[model samples]
Target: MRYNKEDLIEWIIRERQPGGQMFERFTERARKVIVQAQEEARKLNQNYIGTEHLLLGLI
Candidate 1:
Protein backbone atom coordinates (compact mmCIF):
# COMPACT_ATOMS: atom_id res chain seq x y z
CA MET A 1 0.00 0.00 0.00
CA ARG A 2 1.12 3.51 -0.83
CA TYR A 3 0.16 6.86 0.70
CA ASN A 4 -0.41 10.24 -0.87
CA LYS A 5 -0.70 13.68 0.69
CA GLU A 6 -4.46 13.98 0.20
CA ASP A 7 -5.18 10.63 1.77
CA LEU A 8 -2.94 11.42 4.73
CA ILE A 9 -4.51 14.82 5.20
CA GLU A 10 -7.99 13.34 5.08
CA TRP A 11 -7.04 10.75 7.65
CA ILE A 12 -5.69 13.46 9.94
CA ILE A 13 -8.87 15.51 9.58
CA ARG A 14 -11.04 12.54 10.27
CA GLU A 15 -9.01 11.57 13.28
CA ARG A 16 -9.32 15.09 14.67
CA GLN A 17 -13.09 15.11 14.55
CA PRO A 18 -15.15 14.86 17.73
CA GLY A 19 -14.63 11.81 19.98
CA GLY A 20 -10.94 11.51 19.16
CA GLN A 21 -9.38 11.55 22.61
CA MET A 22 -5.97 10.20 21.79
CA PHE A 23 -4.44 13.60 21.31
CA GLU A 24 -6.31 15.46 24.00
CA ARG A 25 -3.32 15.49 26.30
CA PHE A 26 -0.78 16.36 23.65
CA THR A 27 0.67 19.84 23.46
CA GLU A 28 0.05 21.89 20.32
CA ARG A 29 3.70 21.55 19.32
CA ALA A 30 3.49 17.77 19.67
CA ARG A 31 0.46 17.68 17.42
CA LYS A 32 2.21 19.75 14.80
CA VAL A 33 5.15 17.38 14.86
CA ILE A 34 2.85 14.43 14.37
CA VAL A 35 1.24 16.09 11.37
CA GLN A 36 4.64 16.83 9.98
CA ALA A 37 5.63 13.23 10.56
CA GLN A 38 2.66 12.11 8.51
CA GLU A 39 3.71 14.44 5.75
CA GLU A 40 7.19 12.98 5.87
CA ALA A 41 5.76 9.49 5.61
CA ARG A 42 3.69 10.51 2.61
CA LYS A 43 6.70 12.07 0.97
CA LEU A 44 8.47 8.74 1.25
CA ASN A 45 5.46 6.96 -0.29
CA GLN A 46 5.10 4.98 2.91
CA ASN A 47 1.84 3.62 4.26
CA TYR A 48 3.11 3.75 7.85
CA ILE A 49 5.38 6.02 9.86
CA GLY A 50 8.78 5.06 11.18
CA THR A 51 11.39 6.61 13.49
CA GLU A 52 12.99 8.33 10.53
CA HIS A 53 9.71 10.08 9.80
CA LEU A 54 9.44 11.33 13.37
CA LEU A 55 13.07 12.51 13.29
CA LEU A 56 12.42 14.39 10.09
CA GLY A 57 9.38 15.95 11.68
CA LEU A 58 11.48 17.09 14.62
CA ILE A 59 14.10 18.52 12.29
Candidate 2:
Protein backbone atom coordinates (compact mmCIF):
# COMPACT_ATOMS: atom_id res chain seq x y z
CA MET A 1 0.00 0.00 0.00
CA ARG A 2 1.06 3.52 -0.69
CA TYR A 3 0.53 6.54 1.56
CA ASN A 4 0.39 10.08 0.23
CA LYS A 5 1.74 13.12 2.02
CA GLU A 6 -1.65 14.18 3.35
CA ASP A 7 -2.37 10.66 4.53
CA LEU A 8 0.93 10.42 6.31
CA ILE A 9 0.46 13.82 7.87
CA GLU A 10 -3.01 12.94 9.08
CA TRP A 11 -1.79 9.66 10.48
CA ILE A 12 0.88 11.47 12.37
CA ILE A 13 -1.53 14.02 13.75
CA ARG A 14 -4.22 11.51 14.61
CA GLU A 15 -1.92 9.07 16.30
CA ARG A 16 -4.14 7.29 18.85
CA GLN A 17 -1.61 6.70 21.56
CA PRO A 18 -0.51 8.22 24.80
CA GLY A 19 0.36 11.89 24.28
CA GLY A 20 -1.60 11.87 21.03
CA GLN A 21 -3.85 14.60 22.32
CA MET A 22 -0.79 16.64 23.13
CA PHE A 23 -0.83 17.69 19.52
CA GLU A 24 -3.91 19.73 20.26
CA ARG A 25 -1.88 21.79 22.67
CA PHE A 26 0.84 22.59 20.21
CA THR A 27 1.23 26.05 18.75
CA GLU A 28 0.60 26.52 15.05
CA ARG A 29 4.33 26.74 14.38
CA ALA A 30 4.95 23.54 16.34
CA ARG A 31 2.27 21.74 14.40
CA LYS A 32 3.82 22.92 11.18
CA VAL A 33 7.15 21.60 12.41
CA ILE A 34 5.59 18.18 12.97
CA VAL A 35 4.10 18.26 9.51
CA GLN A 36 7.45 19.17 8.06
CA ALA A 37 9.09 16.34 9.97
CA GLN A 38 6.63 13.91 8.48
CA GLU A 39 7.38 15.33 5.06
CA GLU A 40 11.10 14.89 5.62
CA ALA A 41 10.58 11.26 6.66
CA ARG A 42 8.45 10.61 3.64
CA LYS A 43 11.06 12.14 1.38
CA LEU A 44 13.61 9.72 2.77
CA ASN A 45 11.22 6.75 2.49
CA GLN A 46 11.33 6.34 6.23
CA ASN A 47 8.34 5.00 8.10
CA TYR A 48 9.28 6.52 11.44
CA ILE A 49 10.12 10.02 12.60
CA GLY A 50 13.57 10.64 14.00
CA THR A 51 15.64 13.46 15.48
CA GLU A 52 17.27 14.09 12.13
CA HIS A 53 13.91 14.47 10.44
CA LEU A 54 12.71 16.83 13.15
CA LEU A 55 15.92 18.85 12.81
CA LEU A 56 15.48 19.03 9.08
CA GLY A 57 11.92 20.15 9.61
CA LEU A 58 13.11 22.86 11.99
CA ILE A 59 15.61 24.02 9.41
Candidate 3:
Protein backbone atom coordinates (compact mmCIF):
# COMPACT_ATOMS: atom_id res chain seq x y z
CA MET A 1 0.00 0.00 0.00
CA ARG A 2 2.70 2.45 -0.92
CA TYR A 3 1.34 5.70 -2.31
CA ASN A 4 3.35 8.03 -4.49
CA LYS A 5 2.78 11.75 -5.01
CA GLU A 6 0.85 11.27 -8.24
CA ASP A 7 -1.40 8.70 -6.62
CA LEU A 8 -2.25 11.15 -3.87
CA ILE A 9 -2.90 13.93 -6.37
CA GLU A 10 -5.21 11.68 -8.36
CA TRP A 11 -7.07 10.61 -5.26
CA ILE A 12 -7.58 14.23 -4.29
CA ILE A 13 -8.85 15.12 -7.77
CA ARG A 14 -11.30 12.24 -7.77
CA GLU A 15 -12.55 12.94 -4.29
CA ARG A 16 -13.24 16.61 -4.98
CA GLN A 17 -14.20 16.55 -8.63
CA PRO A 18 -17.87 17.10 -7.80
CA GLY A 19 -17.24 20.42 -6.11
CA GLY A 20 -15.32 21.86 -9.08
CA GLN A 21 -12.92 24.72 -8.34
CA MET A 22 -13.84 24.89 -4.68
CA PHE A 23 -13.08 21.21 -4.31
CA GLU A 24 -9.78 21.71 -6.09
CA ARG A 25 -8.87 24.38 -3.59
CA PHE A 26 -9.80 22.11 -0.74
CA THR A 27 -7.73 19.31 -2.22
CA GLU A 28 -4.69 21.57 -2.43
CA ARG A 29 -5.09 22.46 1.23
CA ALA A 30 -5.55 18.84 2.18
CA ARG A 31 -2.43 17.80 0.27
CA LYS A 32 -0.36 20.41 2.05
CA VAL A 33 -1.62 19.16 5.40
CA ILE A 34 -0.85 15.57 4.50
CA VAL A 35 2.68 16.46 3.46
CA GLN A 36 3.18 18.33 6.71
CA ALA A 37 1.97 15.33 8.67
CA GLN A 38 4.38 13.07 6.84
CA GLU A 39 7.24 15.41 7.59
CA GLU A 40 6.28 15.56 11.27
CA ALA A 41 6.05 11.79 11.43
CA ARG A 42 9.50 11.50 9.92
CA LYS A 43 10.80 13.93 12.50
CA LEU A 44 9.30 11.69 15.20
CA ASN A 45 11.05 8.62 13.70
CA GLN A 46 7.86 7.06 12.45
CA ASN A 47 8.37 4.40 9.78
CA TYR A 48 4.90 4.58 8.30
CA ILE A 49 2.18 7.13 7.86
CA GLY A 50 -1.03 5.92 9.50
CA THR A 51 -4.73 6.72 9.41
CA GLU A 52 -4.48 8.59 12.69
CA HIS A 53 -2.06 11.05 11.13
CA LEU A 54 -4.33 11.56 8.18
CA LEU A 55 -7.31 11.96 10.46
CA LEU A 56 -5.45 14.53 12.46
CA GLY A 57 -4.72 16.49 9.30
CA LEU A 58 -8.37 16.38 8.34
CA ILE A 59 -9.34 17.71 11.73
Candidate 4:
Protein backbone atom coordinates (compact mmCIF):
# COMPACT_ATOMS: atom_id res chain seq x y z
CA MET A 1 0.00 0.00 0.00
CA ARG A 2 1.18 3.46 -0.86
CA TYR A 3 1.36 6.07 1.85
CA ASN A 4 0.57 9.35 0.19
CA LYS A 5 -0.19 12.68 1.78
CA GLU A 6 -3.90 12.00 2.02
CA ASP A 7 -3.33 8.60 3.51
CA LEU A 8 -0.98 10.01 6.11
CA ILE A 9 -3.45 12.76 6.95
CA GLU A 10 -6.24 10.27 7.37
CA TRP A 11 -4.06 8.01 9.49
CA ILE A 12 -3.11 10.84 11.79
CA ILE A 13 -6.69 11.93 12.18
CA ARG A 14 -7.81 8.42 12.85
CA GLU A 15 -5.08 7.83 15.40
CA ARG A 16 -5.81 11.05 17.25
CA GLN A 17 -9.14 9.75 18.47
CA PRO A 18 -10.28 13.32 18.66
CA GLY A 19 -13.44 14.34 20.45
CA GLY A 20 -16.18 16.39 18.90
CA GLN A 21 -14.64 19.24 16.84
CA MET A 22 -11.13 18.74 18.12
CA PHE A 23 -10.07 16.72 15.10
CA GLU A 24 -9.27 19.90 13.27
CA ARG A 25 -6.38 20.57 15.60
CA PHE A 26 -4.48 17.59 14.26
CA THR A 27 -4.62 18.83 10.68
CA GLU A 28 -1.94 21.48 11.07
CA ARG A 29 0.66 19.13 12.52
CA ALA A 30 -0.16 16.46 10.00
CA ARG A 31 0.19 18.93 7.15
CA LYS A 32 3.46 20.19 8.54
CA VAL A 33 4.87 16.67 8.68
CA ILE A 34 3.67 15.98 5.15
CA VAL A 35 5.30 19.12 3.86
CA GLN A 36 8.53 18.37 5.62
CA ALA A 37 8.57 14.85 4.30
CA GLN A 38 8.02 16.12 0.79
CA GLU A 39 10.83 18.59 1.16
CA GLU A 40 13.18 15.91 2.43
CA ALA A 41 12.36 13.71 -0.52
CA ARG A 42 12.86 16.60 -2.89
CA LYS A 43 16.22 17.43 -1.36
CA LEU A 44 17.27 13.80 -1.72
CA ASN A 45 16.03 13.68 -5.33
CA GLN A 46 13.55 10.94 -4.55
CA ASN A 47 10.90 10.32 -7.20
CA TYR A 48 8.33 8.88 -4.82
CA ILE A 49 7.46 9.63 -1.20
CA GLY A 50 7.70 6.21 0.39
CA THR A 51 7.35 5.03 3.97
CA GLU A 52 11.10 5.24 4.47
CA HIS A 53 11.03 8.90 3.51
CA LEU A 54 8.26 9.49 6.01
CA LEU A 55 10.33 7.76 8.68
CA LEU A 56 13.28 9.94 7.80
CA GLY A 57 11.18 13.02 8.40
CA LEU A 58 10.12 11.72 11.76
CA ILE A 59 13.75 11.55 12.82
- Candidate with top lDDT is 2
Candidate 1 residues 1-59, lDDT tens each? 88999999988987765334566688888877777888899898997869999899899
In angstroms, the error of model 3 at 47 is 1.7
Indicate the worst ten consecutive residues by lDDT in candidate 2: 13-22
Off by more than 4 A, model 1: 1-13, 16-21
TM-score of every model versus the real structure: 0.64, 0.62, 0.42, 0.49
**TM-score of candidate 1 on Cα atoms, chains taken together:** 0.64
Candidate 2 residue-wise lDDT, 1-59, digit = tens: 88799988887877844236667898878888888888899899998989999899899
**Could you tally the backbone clashes for each prediction?**
0, 0, 0, 0
Which candidate, 1 or 4, has the higher TM-score? 1
**What is the lDDT for 57 in model 4?**
64
Clashing pairs in 2: none
Misplaced by over 4 Å in model 2 are 1-22
Error of model 2, residue 50, in angstroms: 0.4
- Tens-place lDDT per residue, model 4, 1-59, is 76799988887777644232443565666656665677788899987768877787677
lDDT of 3 by residue, 1-59 (tens): 88899988987887644334543556667766676666666777996668866666566
The Cα local distance difference test for each model comes to 0.80, 0.82, 0.66, 0.67
Predictions ranked by lDDT, top down?
Answer: 2, 1, 4, 3
> Per-residue error at 30 for model 4, in Å?
0.7
